[model samples]
Target: MPDSRDRKARKRDLTPEQREKRQARRREKRHASPEVRFILDNNTRVPVDLRPYSLNWDAARIGDPSYYVIGLAKGGSTLMHELVRSLCEAAGRTYIDVPAALFDQGVEPARAVLDPDWLRSRDGSVFGGFRWLHPWMDNLALHERRKIVMVRDPRDILTSLYFSHAYSHVAPETGRLADTFDEQRTQARAQSIDDYVAGPVSLRVFRNYCHLLALTRMPDFRSYRYEDVIFEKRQWIRDLAADLDIRCPEDRLDAIADAHDRQPEAEDASNHVRQVAPGDHVRKLKPETIDLLNRRFAPVLAEFGYGTAS
Candidate 1:
């Protein structure tokens, strides 16, 4: 009923406490909404449909959740998993390979949602080998548990992915997943690295990095970079073990790090350990492609302290 000037005057007349209360009420209303949306830089909205899962805090307490080590694909997850498994062995704890089990059954991380009951049953276990964060993982009631996320430079990730798919990664002789890998290999071989990294095939990798950043928003989640994990293996292992409450002798930790510290002298496309050096993209990708990747991944680079493209 009031005119525009009258409404503006009323808004300006509100006291600080009144304004704070209004903002709090708006936040509460927004949190009460069922749909959750994440807005990326290019005005792309990723809608997470949370309707199927029970997001209630009480429901999340169905079982005792294990510690989780999540990684971005081709981001040193395999090594991290091995290190965690070694630590678990030293600590006399169970290490559950969730991803490997799922992979054996032909379920890739992108195509699978972790079973709440299965997770609930694994009390006091160390769960490793996860490479993707699905929205359904939010259903887990592990707010008090320690979760580790590993990430790498997006450009390096793309370079490694190209080589892994086109050359090194092994695929089974048959199955839908094998067929999918075959298609990827064929495409990777047919296209230049620049085209492959900038094209649609690499979009999922970018999305995974976005999800990794989002997961870091949680109080219990800590993110580690692949560079640090590689260059500073002993300290990284020590810090991670302390965070997970795993007690191991310093000598044992040193032994584990020493066992995996061997780096290849040169890039070998046929082997999984192609190269461990950072900035491989500078050597592999075109200048324009690297510039485009920097702009596209500016948020991740800045957040993770990788330095933006010049």
Candidate 2:
């Protein structure tokens, strides 16, 4: 029942070896959980149980459970993350991003949330983050939670993925998870977005998209369209807030949306307010690539009420 400040002070009193031991144990628990792996393998749905080791990262029950927002990598997750964080802060709750442990391997330090101490500190706060995989649902069964899946036009997702890699810090050498495109990623970086879309990069995006779509089969999952997140920001924010039980003023919600709104002209990947346009795929994709996407992603596009590329 100690205050956060007291917890921090006490944590600081621990010996370096003790801290290292705790960290090692946390890493072990994340990797060694058979139940989590089993649920993931079976694609287990609602009314599941979350393992205590995964939930109580620090062996203390001080952190709040997460309300997750999951989606494909380039599927407007950043914008949704910004809006969610703002609402959480406004509602006096802490917001946590995706922990690297939730991923299968090779987590970048900046995005990793596996630290036992950090996860425990957000007690009574909201946990928000993206999961590229479906098995992550297992980790949430232990707490009260809601999930939001962000969907984007597959063609646009490919376009953004190309630009995100070409312009941003994400690259094979940067420890990105694009192992499938390793051979061609460097060449694709120098090539035009159009060419990238026609090459291995396109396949990478397609495979990732399909991977995420497979999770839709699981029950109790709700989704947000990337286009809705961009154009219908206010309504989306309001609805999401209601779903997560975080009440915020409409004006405040609008302000947060405006602040995080995507700039259609933003070419800077590092800039949070990146290009916000829907259908950039039309401009950047070749006719053949467009055909391929329409054919390959037809089911998802149809299910989400998205028309094929022009």
Model 2 poorest ten-residue lDDT run: 45-54
Scored against the true structure, residue 187 in model 2 reaches a CA lDDT of 67
Tens-digit lDDT track of model 1 for 144-237: 5678888888889999999999999988654356778889999999999999999985678778777777667777888888987798999988
Q: Which prediction has the highest TM-score against the true structure?
A: 1
Clashes of 1: 0
Pull out the clashing pairs in model 2.
62-123, 63-123
TM of each candidate vs. truth: 0.76, 0.64
| Global Cα RMSD, each model | 12.1, 11.7
Q: Which stretches of model 2 miss by more than 4 angstroms?
A: 1-66, 100-125, 134-145, 170-185, 190-192, 264-274
Candidate 2 structure quality by residue, lDDT tens digits, 79-165: 776687778767765454543333333333223323233333334444555635433334344234445678888788777777666
Clashes of each: 0, 2
In angstroms, the error of model 2 at 237 is 1.4
